[model samples]
Target: MDHDNILETNGLNHWFGAGEVRKQALFDINLTLKRGSFTVLMGPSGSGKTTVLTLVGCLRAVQEGSVTLLDRQLNGATEAELVALRRRLGFIFQAHNLHESLTATQNVMMGLQVHRGVSDAKAQTAARHALDLVGLSDRVSYLPANLSGGQKQRVAVARALVGNPALVLADEPTAALDKDSAAEVVDLLKRMGAERGTTTLLVTHDNRILDRADCILTLEDGRIVRVDDRH
Candidate 1:
């Protein structure tokens, strides 16, 4: 394991279905993300961007190749080990995925619920602070249905960051937002990566996000085709 890298994959490969119908989804995917770096994975649909994200995120088991995350190999890990590793990661999705009945604070608190032993009061306080960081302090009590699309996404961002996870995995987080909202969310993620030393691997096709990335990896036909490092 390289001390500076938060994630590393070598000879990563994947396929769906059994031997006869197995269709390759990823091939020889060798990649790495430096600690606290903000990396974007871009590719067209069916180019296997999400597959890489899922593999590195520990959401799916690694079939072939080696995945070392936070210093642990994922290739033949048990389910229990995967569960513990996942707790150290934060996830954001295009849908926001907030519970409709829960208020912003409550929703954000769910992020901490995954970890055992945090008191309710502490969780609530942390949730509120996270909301404030996202400029939603005044709307902490609002439910998802009551908040604007951007505001809801901000809540999602807060939830993802509330735990101070070592890494964050986001899939098309800005896809449903307007121009301003998308920019706001992207900026917030960058800020978190800078201030909290949080590593991020965001999967997006939106070119707007490219400018904010420290590095961008472009995938095509299950292979990384381009690597752009911006400062």
Candidate 2:
């Protein structure tokens, strides 16, 4: 791994089942993500983009190779160790995944609750700051149902950032939004990366935001076929 890189995966392979029914989702993948860089992963459906994100986020285990995040090895890491590693990662899914019963501010604060010794006042303060960063200060009191698709996603982003994680993993965050909304969300991501120096890895089919990424990796049939540096 390069000294400047925050994530590195070598000979990473993942497979399911056995014999004739075996399925390979990723194979012989090697990649590096530098700290404070915004990277995007794009591929056709079933091309393993989501799998790569999940693996790096410690949501899935590496079946064949090795994964290192923040200088910690992920392969065969114990449950406790993985949990600790995951605390430095934040994930955003296509569904937003906010609690319908909770307001946007409350939802964002929920992320801070995972860490010990964080008081409610501190959590709420952090959540408000995150929402403000994402341009959602006014919507903090709204519930998921009261918000638009993009607003809901911004709240999700707020939740992701509230923890001040070293890495942010987003899975097709614009999938459920309109064109204008999608662009808005992508712009917000760009601003966040530029201003905060947070490492962001977004898995998306949207090509419009490709130019905004500092690095782009394309995957096909479970392998990284190409890497591009836009900066």
Candidate 3:
């Protein structure tokens, strides 16, 4: 494994379902991601893009081949090991996935509370700073129901980044926003990744975000067809 590469996959493959319904989702997928780089995974639905992201993100059990995340093998890692590894990553989903009952600040604080030994005061301070970075300082006390779709997504971004994770896995994070809001979200991810050397692997179908990526990877029928390096 190259230390500079935050993620590496070699001859990776995955399957779903069982018996006659069993189907292959990934085919000999080999990929490498450099630290601090913002990469987009693009393809039509059922192209295995999300599967690749989940494999690298440790969200699913690796079924075949090799996946080295942060220099640790994920193929047969114990559940405890995987749980420990997950603490080092952050995830942003298509839905904001915020707790409706919690204030924006409280939602962001949940990000840090996952890690052991973080005090409530310290978590509050970090959460406030993260919200500020995402331009949500004033909305920290607002509930999810009170915020706009863009503001909700911004809160999700703040929550994902509050831990200062080594890797961020985002799935269609900007899919629900308007043009300007989508741009803001993508640009924010790019800027924060650049500044903190946080590697980002985002899965999206939004064409608008292509230009912001350091690299763009396209998958087709469970295979990588093209890799465009814009940086």
What lDDT would each prediction earn against the true structure? 0.93, 0.88, 0.93
Residue-wise C-alpha lDDT for candidate 2, range 205-230, written one tens digit per residue: 98877877888999989988998988
Stretches > 4 Å off in candidate 3 = none
Error of 3 at 209 (Å): 0.9
lDDT by residue (tens digit), candidate 3, 167-225? 99999999999989999998888888779998899999999889899999999999999
**Clashes (N, CA, C under 3 Å) per candidate:** 0, 0, 0
- The TM-score obtained by model 1 is 0.98
| TM-score of each model, in listed order | 0.98, 0.95, 0.98
Looking at candidate 2, the ten consecutive residues that score lowest on lDDT are 189-198
How accurate locally is residue 20 in candidate 3, as Cα lDDT from 0 to 100?
A: 100
How far is each candidate from the true structure, as Cα RMSD in Å?
0.9, 1.3, 0.9
Clashes of 3: 0
